[model samples]
Each structure stands twice: as structure tokens, then as C-alpha cells.
Target: MLPLSPAPAWAVAGAARVRPGDAAWPSAARWQQLGEQVGGRLIRVQSPLVACRSEPASAACAQLFKAVKNPYFIGDDVALTQTLGWVDAWTSMPSAYAVAARHTSDVVAAVNFAREHRLRLVVKGGGHSYQGTSSAPDSLLVWTRAMNAITLHEAFVAEGCAGQAAPQRAVTVEAGAMWSQVYDAVTTQAGGYVQGGGCMTVGVAGLVQSGGFGSFSKRYGLASGSLLQAEVVTADGQVRIANACTNPELFWGLKGGGGGSLGVVIRLTLRVHELPEDFGAVNFNIKATSPAAFRRLIGRVLDFCSQALIDPHWGEQIRFRRDNTVQVSMVFQGLTRSEAVAVWQPLRDALAREPGDFVVDSSPLSIVSTSARDFWAPTLVKRVLGFIRRDERPGAPRTNVFWPGDQGQAGQVLHGFESAWLPAALLQPNRRDALGDALFAATRHWPVALHFNKGLAGAPAEAIAAARDTAMNPAVLDAFALAILGTQGQPGYPGVAGREPDVALARQQAQALGRAMAELRRLVPDAGAYVSESNYFQPDWQRAFWGANYPRLQAAKRRYDPDGLFFVHHGVGSEDWSADGFSPRT
Candidate 1:
């Protein structure tokens, strides 16, 4: 490599990253040297959809759109994320260059290069961030997609915890590995379970860092809580092992402290659990004939939930729609189909008695149970039912499958997305009516989906205890559910003629979702929002996302990455930098 260039005058005056056009930007020779250091894994990033700009009618353009709908294809590409962009917030912008890291050393090289050059740095593992943290323009990306590897242990202990901690069955997952792969290995093949994101294609590392949740979280806990150890490459380009008995504070910070803020995690070891015998679901919709009937229905539903479903057995969502419909899509574990039916019998009977006010779907309510191990087994699930969509691309892995419900999020252009954790106190008999009214009014502005599993209330004691130890907001321990209101359009990217995002519709939907969230916030005046799926323009994000834990997380950031080499939107220690994370706030 040639000798380094002189520092730009602007950089000498104040702190700012070296942009592509800056005088201090790395030379082509320098980039090539860094690439060679990583074994030629560096990629000159480019979106496949860029070709559509000049040749809209070409066959290649058609193929690109088709592939955009398949999340597996999106996950495999370093230039794309499951969410293409958020309206008026950000669009997926590929970095100037990316190191497709196949080993921890590659990540160290990329980090050292970024720091030495004073360049903006970004990290991507799952590339599924709705907040657009994984994609940034004019930056160097540490792409860990090629580093995926999974290893299981019958009895494992942290590196420095031989005497301090007991041996437990765990799974060691590489940064690039997805939840689908972990599920297949731990659940389907080994007859065990791993707490992870419900989205099968979501990267394991990102999920754990952002306080992951899943269908069985009520029984298990947040994925962050299950993390036993992690190997991270920090800003100093040093590979550090973090666990309970070693670098314990960094380990806590890595748990629910938000990804891309602390460091690039190369690998993780998560404690796994014994598999349950059965997994079951309940699905149905009820339509009310009048506004008064809808209010009554809401109250009755809340009452029923408080009476029966406030336990570790149930998870998933219950949606309240603008069309006066209540959609129930809930799952259960460790329960027989008959037992599950019996638990819901009273609610069914109450709705039936009010035939004049409410009408249930003609298709009878579905309450079915299946073997727990087959839940994530792609081949077995395909043989038993059409519950998943497989990656049909040539030579795709047989395990590359996602739930049909998650299809719309792949490469989606987001209009609006907002969520608030609803405290379990709202379920009290005295407060249930007010909570019902708030939910009803919120639906008038937009639909709201209450994801029960996202909150830790009503969970097992062990689950709650584990979650409390992480850096996540304490509000989650008492939150009964996370109320979410979001809207989106089809896969579209910016600067693509005739395929650009519909800004007008997006703004309108965003306002509606905001109003819907406002109504719910009236009841829980100080609700905390999940960091991964929160408002892009949240004013007091530090408090809303991490609550009292913000100061501690900031301290950890200063300890590990005091120079702020790692930057993501709203991440810890980000308040000292510019919005783009390229310049110091001063």
C-alpha cells in the first residue's frame, strides 16, 4: 500500500468521518490492501435493483423483484435488508465497501482499518433491522453473513466459569447464523429448544443484542437472557470473551444494549432448554355489528384474558382492526388440544350468547395441537401442512423456510411502525374497562396488534428473573403485551423510477399509527418501547427504549468504545455524535 494521504483541514479543525469525496479518504490502493488482509472477501457493494433505473423492462429487473419477495435471498445479500426502507426516515444504502467476514480476524482487520482512516463503520449480521441500522451510505461494512456456523454441547461452561457456574446444554452460533438454522439443529434434530426471534431468517446475533422474543418467550424468556457467552471484536480491534465470570459488565451490556453500538459480535453461546411435548394454536375472528357492540366485545375479551390467559402457557397476538373485527392468533405449549379448548370454552360461550351483537366466522374456530419438535422441521411441517413458504430459488437450502405471515415484511417499504409496552396492571378488574376503551379508541385511528410474548409479565419466574438481569428496560417485566401499529407498501427502493416509495400514503399512515399509539399511551403514561421496532423520530429515545438502564449502558460504551467508532441510530453513546454519526455533536 502507498503512504497515507495528508489529513483534511476540516478533520483537523473538528471531528468528522472521512467521506468518499474527502481528501483524507482512503486511496484505492489502501482499500485493496485491507481487502487482501481479509483474504479478498471485501465487496464493492451494489444493489441488484440499481439496474432497474436504466432498464425497467429488462428480464433482470423482473428477476430482481421476484427475488426481493423471498427473505432468504434478501438475507443472503449484503446490499439488502428485509426492510428496504422506512418512508421519510431512511432507505437501504449499501456501504462504499464491505468485508464479507468469514472469520473473527476479518472483523478485526475491518475495525482497525475504519479506526485508522477515521471512517464511519457499520456492522451487519442478520440485516433485518427495521430501524435501518445495518445499512449506511459511504461507510465500510463488516458483513458477517459468511461466518455462519453452529455447534452444540451436551454440557458447556463459560471460558472462565468452570467453578463459578454449572454446566448446561447450550448452542454456539456464529454471527451469521439465522434462527431457522438454530431451530433445526436444537429443536428438530436434537429435541431441544432455543429462545430466538419468531422471524426465521432474522440473524441470531442482532436478535440477542436487541432483546429477542419468540412464540415461546412466555415459557422461556428473552433470547438476550439466555446468552451464556459471546465473542466480540470491539473498537480497539481486540477479540474479547464476555460471560458471567469474565468481562461480566460487557456481557450485560451486550444483552439488550442494542446492536452496532457496543461491538461486532463474532459468535454467541446460548443456553438451550428441553423440548415440550406439544405446541398448539387458536385462530378465529369476530366482527361486531355496531360501535356499542365493539366496545362490549373488547371488554369481554379483556375480562376473558384476565381470567384465563394470564399465564406462561399462551403467546402470540390479538389484533383490533378498524373494520370492527377482533382477530385472535395465539399459540400455546405444554398443553393438549382438549385442555386448550376447555380453557377457551367460557369465552366462546359468552360470544355465542350475544349472537345479535357479534358474529363469529363461519369457519369454526381452529384449536389444534402438533408435536413440538415438528414445529420448525421444514420437511415435516411441509408434509403435515402448508404453514410455511420455502425458498424456491435453485439450490437453496431445504431449511430456508419462513412463516407465511412474515412474507409481507421481506423487502417491504415501511409506511409507519410504532409500539408501546402495555403494563399488566391494565388487566386489573377495576382498570380493564379503561384499558378496553383505550384500545377501542386506538383502533378507530388504526389497527393495533397486541403481541403477548414480547412482554415478560405472566411469564415463568425463572424467565422474568433472567430478563431482569439484562440491560432491557425494567418496564418489560410488568408489561402484559406490546401494542404495535404499523403499515407498509410493497418492496420499493429510492431513486428507482416508477418504483419509488409512495411518500404521501406513507405520511398519512404514519400519522394514523402515531395517533393510535397516543391513545394507548394515555393509560400507561410512561410506557417503554422496544428498541428494535420503535418510532424513527422518537424524541426521548434513551428513556423510552432503555429507561433507567441508559446511564449504565453509556458507561459500558465509554469503557469499551470510548472513541465512538461503532455508531447506530439511537444506540448507546450516540447523543455525542451527529445524526448521520459522521461528525461530533459539538
Candidate 2:
């Protein structure tokens, strides 16, 4: 790979920044304080137990805000007002109060309390779910980030003893454990590894729900497909287990179904594989000048990906991070750099020369990064690069949104949605500057990029079934298709999700891009399947992505979360938006 360079001349010159606007404050506080006067209950978590060898209450609410008592935060607690994550989420200001849950039992208690009291609740795992479904307007958030538990199973794939160990082995991890933590533990302790871990922090539960992606998926399978068992706390507040033995159908549904379905996953168990000593990592960043080269490059990369599926000795990832920049990163399980060159030579040769007015030196590259390729990819480069758009001058208003989540080992695409304000008034141009500043500020660590499967050609039928049916299922596809709109970033972008400071401008962009992408799909072909993280697929698209698992998954939803507590933002059960003050205006 070539040495990193400064932002290109065009990029530096054309810094088209997007910002957020001021927002109307939520009235939940009034409802909470006022409702408490009546027979109603508004749960305001105040920590009971202080482990500081001091105070006490037998039972305690989550102490997340208190636990995060950094001077950086002023008076606002969960309603954190100043942080970048907070600013990003078009939150009018920082959160004032945040609930903290210490364990799964606490999670269950929180859910039941909200259920019993009729309070709207949002579940937060790693704060990485960029869809803002992880957060909401004046709702009680069930924070699960504190329940960080991770266990790597030795019986699953004992090192130096694959055939000698138990037939099947796995790892048990709490839903809150970040992907980074999981990788650290497995690489060192358990001797196993994530499927295709990406470069970010993530919680397994949310990552799986979004039909996780990774470099390894090209060969082995998706992270969701690795599910063996899971401990879930359902709407009724009952902690249930979903797995092959307990609730096999539901377990299958949970595999690739979107998050917040069936229940809040408290724990996840995944099938583990023996660690390879010589996995491969290769990357090439290219800038194309002519349309011919761009088109040919895409075709060639896709061809390589198609071929890699047949050879376990192969893995390929091609990404067009920007209009001019494209990078193809590949991983090989047993193949060496020499063998990989031979396989990639055809694709390389195709891009050797330029057609007309050739200027930008567009090309592909490959290298061996890690000792054992392990789990790695170039998506992070694109994402991180794209994410570094804003300013750092402490005084500016932050990005209008926030989504917190991490990339799991199976090349999890970490997405954390933050809040951003979208005023009811449409003609507000005053917000553009602030919104732009916020977006730039909040995305320092984020990289807004798109990625897809590189190889899945000649694997076992069951493996293919898992990817198509479970991970890339219809319902999940809907969630992923919408994810593209978030390429600029996640929800809370005010202008996204059909809302905006300038409705007309927003509409124009949406329609234009929608038409353009549709045409592209017809030509070069858009990705048929998408991870649930950026799911934008509607019913038809969902059906197309899933093929045949809709009925089975619906049945599972009925059986497990019969009370309608478990649901996606626009899921089957959540169709009744009217009750929640939402209308189908558009």
C-alpha cells in the first residue's frame, strides 16, 4: 500500500460540510416531574449503592452518569449536554440524567419497570447503533454498556488440537463487551478469534442483529451465523435463553434479524474456530480519472471476489471510499503473497493503462500486514478518513447526532448514532452552519463508508443459507437499505430520515440520489444485500433480500415477544406508529 498522503487537492478545496440546527427541547421532563405527583411513576435513576466503602441502598439504579462523573460534563447527566457524542445526536443540549445498569438482572428490572409504568424505552448497548433507534426523544434509555462480560471457550477450538478437541466449541460474551475487548481476550486467552473483526469497538448483540460484515465472512461466514446460544431479557421481563435446544426457531430469527427484536440480548455465545497463523492482509488505494478505468476496476475486483469463494486460500475486499479513491483489501487464509499475486494479476492487468485524459493514478495494491492475517480490512480506512471532516475548537456546537457501537470481530461495522436537532420549521437556513460544524466535530473518530461482501462463492450450502436467510434476510435488508442514506452519517442528521432544516433541499438530494443509485444498481449493480446496521430496505426490498425466512421469523417474534415489546423501528409489530405520535405523512 502507498504511504498515506494529505487530503487530495479536490477534497481540500471542496469541503462541502453539513451541519445541524437548533431543536425544540423535549417535554419529557415536565411529564416526568408532573407525572410523579400523580399515581404514575417516572423512573429517575439515583444510585443506591456507593461501593466507595460508603453509602448504600439495597437496590440501586444504573449509575452510568454518576460513574461517568467527569468534569467535562456539567450539570446534565444522562442528558449529557456537551460531549461530542451528545452534540452529534441533534440533542438540543446535553443529557441531564443517564441511567446505569450493572447487570442483566438490572436490565430485566429496568425493562419490567418501563413495561409496568407504560414508559417509552430505548436500549443502548455500545452507543454505536447509528440509527438513533438506540436513543430517542425524551424516552427512558435502558443502558446495557455496563454489563461487560466476555468468556472465550477452550473446548470450542483448542489450539494445536482441532480434531482432538470436542466436536463443537464456542465463546460466551456479555452483550456489552466491546469488539476490541473480545478480540483481545480471544487472541490471548481462548486461542480462538472473531470471524472478521474490523477496526473499532462493538458489542456482539447489536452487531449480530445488523447482519455483521467482515473480511472473514468472504470465506467462513457472517458474525450472526456464528450464533450458538444467547441469553435474552424479553419484554415481559423474563430472562430467556435462545439456542438450538431452548428456542431454536427464535434463536435462528435472532441470528440475522435486526436488534431490539424478541428481547434485549444480555449474552451471546458464538461458534469459535481454530486460529490461523498465516491469514493475509492486502490493500490498494486508487484514484481513477476516467470512467472506463473506474468501470473496469470495479468489474475486475468483483471477479476476484467471485473467484475467491472457491479457494479457501483466498479473500478479497474492494472499496470505493470516495468518488476518486478506491481501495481493494484482500485476506487469504492459507495462500501466500505469491499465490495471491497470480490470482490478482488478471484484475491488475486490466487497470494497467488509462483511456482518455488519464490523470489520477488509479491502481490496486496488496500486502501482508499481520503475521497471521487474522481479522482485518480496509473499511476502517475509508470510514475513518471520511469521518475526519469537522473542527476541534471546543466552543463550537457539536454534530447534531450520536450513535455508539463497535465493529465486532467478524468485520463488524461499528455504528453509533448521536442526537441532532431537526426543527419543525422547514425554512431554517440559520442551522446550516451549526449543523455543519457539529457533523465535522462529531465524526473525528468515525468513518462514513460503505462496504459489502467480497467472496461467498463455493462454501457449504448451510453457510450460504445462513448468510442469505439469516444475515441478509428480508426484514434485515429493509434496515440495511436505509443505512445508505446514512452514508454521510447515521440518523439524527435532522435532514436524514425524511426530515431536514431545509426540506426542499433535503428532498431534492434524496430524490436525485435515489434515482442515481437505482440506475447504478441497474448498471454496475448495487449490493443486493446489506447489513442491518444501515438497513434502508422496505418490505419489497426486504422480501428480496431474505428470499424465504420472513414467515419463520414472524412466527418466532410472535412466540417470543408476544406482547409487542420486541420490535424494530418500523418492524411488523411496530406498524402502529399512530399510537406513538408518529404519522405517515411522507
Candidate 3:
């Protein structure tokens, strides 16, 4: 690894600067001291390569291989997973140190220490950020996973809302709590539910900070919209409470501003909704013998979304693969099996009307009803099915039932991908067909999947307008304007993988997505893109991520973090710093 130059005198004394191979680099004794300072929770991470080198034929190596084989298993542990492995490698180019923050005070101490020592600091919540903002080269990482805690309030009020006439139901979640943990807590422990991400292992703080979207988004609004208050440790090491009536500007920024930009969010208080007794869902799969049939199927599904799925109560996801197959899973909050079919009659009729060759075979359309609590339980069946159906690994022989769980080398190198917003206008039958054709042609040579998440659509006009009240781009609201209201582009989900091991091929795919996104942006130049899911190297990033809100967010960054102490790739005010957390070369 190339060594970074010394810090400027104004930032820190010469003796205080720490960098890999420098005299100031923390030794084991220094690490112990730092741990003591943070209540003895600091941990020195071993390189995965080193961890897997325990006598290649030993049980230890076998167990390590097993643990790393499953992405989900690695992701569940806060220490193992970094959303994009390539970014992690880059971030660790310069030696990295971590502080497992267990309390607000620990974060405050970490911030103060890093600031005093002129060290780049990165806050990690779940470490699932698609852009890998949670990690940085030569930085002190404040890991919040140890601080997981949840508190439910029957009659909750915002920090400064005591005078309000109504007290809302709320849950206060620490930064480290995963979505699944929060889901179980609210549903079983508190008899309530808060609109959250679909992924079980996503961290609440990172999701909410980046303007969360999920199955209930159309009904309850984005997760950020439900935020009532937050406790944050700013760059100056001060812990402050932000709410509608206190530090309101900060509160507004925190709601939708991308994570790791403004401050380290220690805790969040979000409003909750009562859980319905029962909910309905439909799972459908259609296989087409040819690409023409696949296109026809896609057209039909888009037509259905444009017509029958506009109700906020309806939620669904549609996915299409290169093999000319489509799978659609839909859920309705209050509808029963028959009621759902009645509502879906138009789509059913459309499918029936399609030419006989359009579908080679299809599963019978059916609705499965279950109690809300039971319906939300995490199940391994879907994952197992996905594993069974996954395309053969490159260069591997195709097989109906092959498990390569323990066949790979100890350390694996992963790649990153880019996701772009799709304009809502393209949901129209003709436009949808055009968009589908464009995507199919653009990714024909790559193994990328095209997914249309319908559940995140149809957000109420008022809700869209409300997004403007926070730092979140109003374009996100417009993206939800599907079908009759004219289409708008929607932000892409960050978790989707669109990468290739070949750097050149990855760049080619990224460029394709970027070109597509650029065209979509031209349709609404004033709109913004989703920061979390966008290309890290996006041009005109401020406008693409925050739109008209960029100016205000920049001003807030300057005010709250004057020294530019809080920095991340693609974050607000980050342009002033280089990707390696250093001043850019002129």
C-alpha cells in the first residue's frame, strides 16, 4: 500500500498523526489503551485471509470456510460483512482501526479523540451501505453494533412535543439494531409495526438516514418520514437531541439526508402503526419459451401495475431475468384470497387475453392469507429456493441440485455494482416496453437482473410533498407517481448486486447504467437521485443526490462540521475531500 503524506500542521501536531508504517501507528499497547478509554470494547480485526490460514486441512479452516460461504450468514455478524467487498479492500488500503462503541459517551470520546488526533473517522452502522461510506482508508471506525437497544412507548411524544394534543406510538431504536430485530420487537413485544426495509439484516439507522423504502412505504410513507427524533454526536463531539421543536433544521436534515454526512446518529425515535390482524399475499411465476413471450409477459405485468395496483394498500415486486421468466410477489394489507383475486381480475383477464404462445407454463395464481404476525416471520424457504434456482457459477457445470458451499478458496474477492432510478413515465405499456427493450439490450452481454419494485410505489401526494419538508429529494416522491398521474423516476435500491469480477466488464456495466441514469435525469433535471443506491463516481453528484436541497445540506454541513471533520465518499461536503480522506491534487 502506498503511504499517505503527513497531516497538515493546522489539523494536528506532527507527532499525533497516525498512518500505516508511521511511528505513531498504534501498537498493541496503544490499542489496549484505546480500548480502555472506550470501556474495553475495541477490537483489532484480523484480515479474513489471515483468519482462514489455520493449517489448510484443519477443522478451523473448514469452519471458517463454511462461515464465509453464506453471504447472509456473514452479513448477520456486524464484524464480518462490508456490503461491497471491493470498497472494503480499498478502505483498508491504509491500516484501519475500530472502536466498538457501546454507548453515546463512547462515540463522543471517539469523535473527540479522532478530531484531536486529526484522524479520519468513519461511523459504521450495519456496514451495509452500498457505496461503502461506512468504511474509509486510514480511518478510525466507530462501530455501533454493540449498542443495539430498543424501547417501546405506548404513548410517545417527541422531545419537544409535550404540549401537543396527541401523543404518538413510537419506538426508540439504537443505531445498531437490525430491521428484523425491530420487526420482532414491535410486532411481538409491542403489538405494533413501523414501516421498515424488507431485508432482515439492514441496520435501522443507515436505512432511515438514507430515506428508507419498503413494502409499507406507500401506506406509511418512507421510513425517514416516520422519524420523530434522534440523538446525534456531531463532529465536535457534542451529543444533541434533534426533533421538530428542537434543532429543527438538524432534525429535518437527519430525516432524509444521506447517512454519515451530518453526524453519527446514536438513536432514533420513529412512529409506529398498529398491526392488522391478517394480511394477504400472492406469489406467481411465469415461464416463457422465447424472448418475445417474455417481453409480452413483462408488458402485461406493467399494465397490471399501471391499472390495478395503484391502491396504497397494495404492495408487490416484479422481477425478470434473461432466460425469459418472470416472478411476481404481491401483498395486500387487508384483502383476503378472493378479495385479492377480485382486485387482480383486470391483470388476470389481460393474461388470459394474451396470445396462446405468450406463456409456455405458469403456476396457478393464488392468494395465501395469514395473520400479520405470522406473515412477517423470516423464513429460510425463500432463500433456499433462490439458491436452488441461481444460475450456475461461471465456468461451473450446470446441475439441477449442486451445492458448492465448501468448494471455494478461503478468502474471496467480491465486486461492486451500480443502480439507477427508473422514470415513472416508463411504466406505461408502450414506454414500459421501450424501457424493457433498452435494459435487455444494454445488459444482454452481462449477467445482470432487472427488477421492478412495485410495492414502493403509489405514495400519497401529501406524503410526496412532505418529503420536501426534509432533505430528501422530492423526485423520490415523483417516482411514486406511476400509471395515470404521469411517470417519474424512482431511486434504486442499494442492496442489488450488478458487478463482475472483471474490472473492465464492471466498468462497462456501470457506464451503461450511468448513461441510462443520465437520460432519466434529463427528463427531470431538477430532481435528485437516491444517494445510498447511486453510483459512487456519479457526475454532478450533489444535484443527482439532493437536487435543490443540496445548497441547504451543504450549508448545514459547514455549520455543524466546520472543519469538515465528518466525511464520507459521496456524502454532503465530501467533494472538498478525496476518496482516501485527503486533500485532492490540484
Candidate 4:
């Protein structure tokens, strides 16, 4: 175990390191002092060392473990729960210290301390990062959970939009604010809404930075597209704003480039849409008695997606589980129930034409007509529908409502599960048959969940092409063409837990995921992946996530974060650093 080292001359007032096996290791006062130095609170959350202790449990160990056990269940302690995948064996490495940041100064102070100490630094927002990029072993964690603040403006003008158009309604959210918080403030306080992630507990900064998708994505655009300005603390400890008229290149990279790679985002301003008067949703549950029937149902849904549902006003999610159960959930804006049904008549007609002996349970397929305020009520979303896991019940129904509250025990349920994404094109008739056959054969030995949607399909070509100006993959905009013969994978949902206590078994499972991803890559070499929901072990992460944009993103990293102060697994310039903050390239 490493011993505590002396502080550097430039260390902050109370900055100190708590190393393993040190005499000061068990002192809560020492941890508290370090937190005070940065003008924030310190928390000793679960770490691998605590989990893998060889000695019999001591009183101190028990207290620490208990304190960290359910850190994410409380909505107010934003710093504690930002690492959703922190429990994974591969991602279980914990920082030596965590600083619950309360302001921009605290972040700047933390960054300086880390640079002086040569310690790895990780920034965390909502901690919903699928790849566990927000955490690492023996690093300094700057948790932004305490910095949540929301400011609403009726007619906000972005720096770039000042001269061209009238001011628009917008909201500026601090880094720690979650999707549910943004949803609540926008719908109620501002009388509007923004297209954001499906999970309310997800951090607004992380989601927008990684190219967010949501129920209103078809109508509005990705959450990233709504970003108007961002206040960031750079690696060099300088606070700056990135927007269309400010540090525009950095602004471009920050949008969809990936979070925790370029800088620590303290605040983000985004455009908001007025609450729609007419909104509708339809739920369908189709059960297949035989394999052929399941195949037919899937094919018809895919056909409906590719043909009849090209409009951005339509949004749907199709979930297929291992038990031959199928569910299709749809939501739309600016349409009444009858109008929505008229638009969806083709899908209903297609289902009528099916010759298979499957039951179409439209009993749950009622249309919802309500205002955005009623549609996105936090009380309704959080208490009733939030925190439901994909593995809870096979073929269970899902809604467009997002709960902006604590996930409680649900956060712990989905730790070690392996997930993958495939493009929407592969769901076509001929290609989908082969893929479904393959998945069915594979699932005979293990359970798998498949989610199908047009998350990035409706954006105009110009919008898709515009992603090239930033770090987001342009391939996302080309879903129609990309889906022709290959498949693109979707991001993982929150709380996909893993139960591999044995390290060896965990490694084996990770290897299997790698092989599976490799096979998927082989099928669709030209298609780019969604960075937010991918596995960290991508063989060629640059090409897999960024495609041709890797070089530009790398340049941005070199220009802004020259010393590599911020490094996330599989993020831009991360190839230069090893898991332990040592250079593998050297």
C-alpha cells in the first residue's frame, strides 16, 4: 500500500492525500479537512479496497460500507450517486478521496490540487454513465452533485442567435441538475419542456454532452442540439464559457463529443419548447405463440418504422424479450387521439394482415390526450414509473413519462448485466430475420433484451451533417441509409447490474461481451456507435464511436487539455492513459 505523501508548495489550504495503509487512513476528520480545503464536503464512499478487504470486518470498515451502501437513493446528495456503474468489477476502482463540489471555485481548486499532486482526476455529474467513465481507482473525484441550480428565462438569447432572431425561452442548469429537475422546472416554472434522456435521474450535463435522446426527440431534436451555452472549468483551472460566439471549437466538441473528456461543465443553457396542448400515447402488447409469429411481428414493426413513421412527430419504443413477448410504446405531439390513430392506421392494418396465431392485446393500447404539463408531471412519473428495471418483468409495458426522483433500490439491481446496441437498419425484413434467428439461438442459453426506436432518425440531413462540426458522430443522422444492410447499437439503460462476485467469471463475461461486440462490428463496419451507451473495451474506440471525427476531437483535446487532466475510459485522448493514470502509449 502507498503511504501518504507530503503536500506540494502550491497545495490548497487544507488539501491532503489519504493513502492506503496510512495511520491517517481511518480518520474521518482528515477526510473532512480535505473537503473543507476545497470549499465542499467529502464523502468516503464504497471502494474496491473496502469490498476486497482480507481482514475480518472492523467497526470502522462496517461504518464506511454502510455509509456508502445506498448513496444514490437520495436525490439531494447529488455527489454521492454519480457513478452508476461503480459496482462493476472492472469499474469498481474507487478514488482515494471524493470532493462534493458546491461551486465553480471548488472545482478549480480541486483541479489545481490534483495537478500538483499528480493524481488522476474524475468529474461526475448524475453518475449515470454506462461505461463507468465517471470513476476510476485511486483517483480524485470531483462530484458535481451539490452544484445543482436552475434558472429560467422567458426570452433568452444565445450568443450566436442574438442578431438573427427573437429571444427564445431557455433554461440554464448547473452541472449537478438531473433530467427530472430540468423536466420539472421547464414544464411547470417555464411552461415548456426540453427533449432529454428517458431517465429522470440522469445528469443533464452528462446527457446533453453525450448527445441525449428522449420521447420528444422526433419533434424537437436531441438534447445536445438544444445546448446554447456552457460554463466550463478547463484542465488548466481556468473557468470559461463555450457557446456559438465564444470558445466555439470547444463548444462544438462539448456537444456530443462525450463528457469528462474536455473539461468540467458547471452550467448549461438550453432552448425549451412550449408545452403542447395536444399530446397522445399508444401502448400495444403483442404476444407470439411461436417463433415464426414473433419474427412476423418484429418484421411488421420494423416496416412500420421505416415506412409510415418517418415524421418527427412520431416516437415509439419496441421492446422484445427472450420469452417471445413483444411490446410497442408510442408517443406523439400536436395530435389528438383520433388523429394519432389515423396516422397509425397502417400499423394497425399490418397487424390485421398477420396470419400467425398471436394475440394483439390492444386492451393496454389506449391513447393519452393531455397537455405537456400533465403529461410530464414529476409526481406521476417519479413515484409510479421511475426506477423500473428492464429485467424486472419480461415484456412489461414502458411509458414516456420520466420520474425525477430517487431510484432507491432499483439503482442497485442493475449492476453487472452486459449490454449491446445495433443499428435500426438491421431490423429490416431480410436482415432482421437472420439477426433475430441468431439472437434467439444465443438467448436459448441466456436472456437478452432488445429495444428498437428512431432516436436519431428524424433529424434533418443538415442537422445530421451539422454534427460533423462537433464531436457527435454524423452517422447518427444517417440512420435511414446506415440501416440498409448493417445495424447500429443503442446505449445501455441505467442500473444494468452484474452479479459476478468471482473476478475470473467477471473477466470471462467481459471477454464474451468483447467478442459479441466484435461480431456486431464486423456486420456493420461503416456505422458509428453511440458513445454514451457503449462498452468501454472497444478494440478501436475512435473509429467505433467517432469514426472520422476522432482526429478533430483529438486535436481539441490537445489544444484545451494538453496535460491530460481529464481522462475517461474510451473518451477522446484517453488512449494515451492507462487505467492507473500511467501512459500505455509510452
Which prediction has the highest lDDT against the true structure?
1
Local error of candidate 4 at 539, Å?
1.8
| Residue-by-residue lDDT tens digits, candidate 3, 285-314 | 666667676666666666676776655667
Per-residue lDDT tens digits of candidate 1, residues 333-429? 9899999999988888878888999998645437878889988776654545667678888998877888889989998999988889989999998
Say which prediction, candidate 1 or candidate 3, comes out ahead on lDDT: 1
Ranking by lDDT: 1, 3, 4, 2
Candidate 4 structure quality by residue, lDDT tens digits, 1-586: 1122232222323233434564544356645666778755666655433342543255654443344333333333333333333224244445767778897888887887776655678888777765767667667788887788999988887666678657888889999887766776787556788778766767889998887767666666668887888999998889988888888889988888899899999999988776787666777776778876776666666667667565566764555644676666667887877888787677776666663657776653455566667555534443454322221233522321233322332233222333334555665666866665554443333333332333456555544444445576666654532211111111111222222234344455455544443444456555566777655444566776676777777778878987677878878776565554434343
- lDDT (10s digit) by residue, model 2, range 244-294: 557667677777766786688888878777777666655666555654555
Root mean square deviation (Cα) for candidate 3: 8.1
Give one clash count per candidate, in the order shown.
Answer: 0, 80, 4, 17
lDDT of each candidate versus the true structure:
0.89, 0.46, 0.62, 0.62
TM-score quality measure for candidate 4: 0.78
Candidates sorted on TM-score, descending: 1, 3, 4, 2
User: TM-scores, in order shown?
Assistant: 0.97, 0.63, 0.80, 0.78
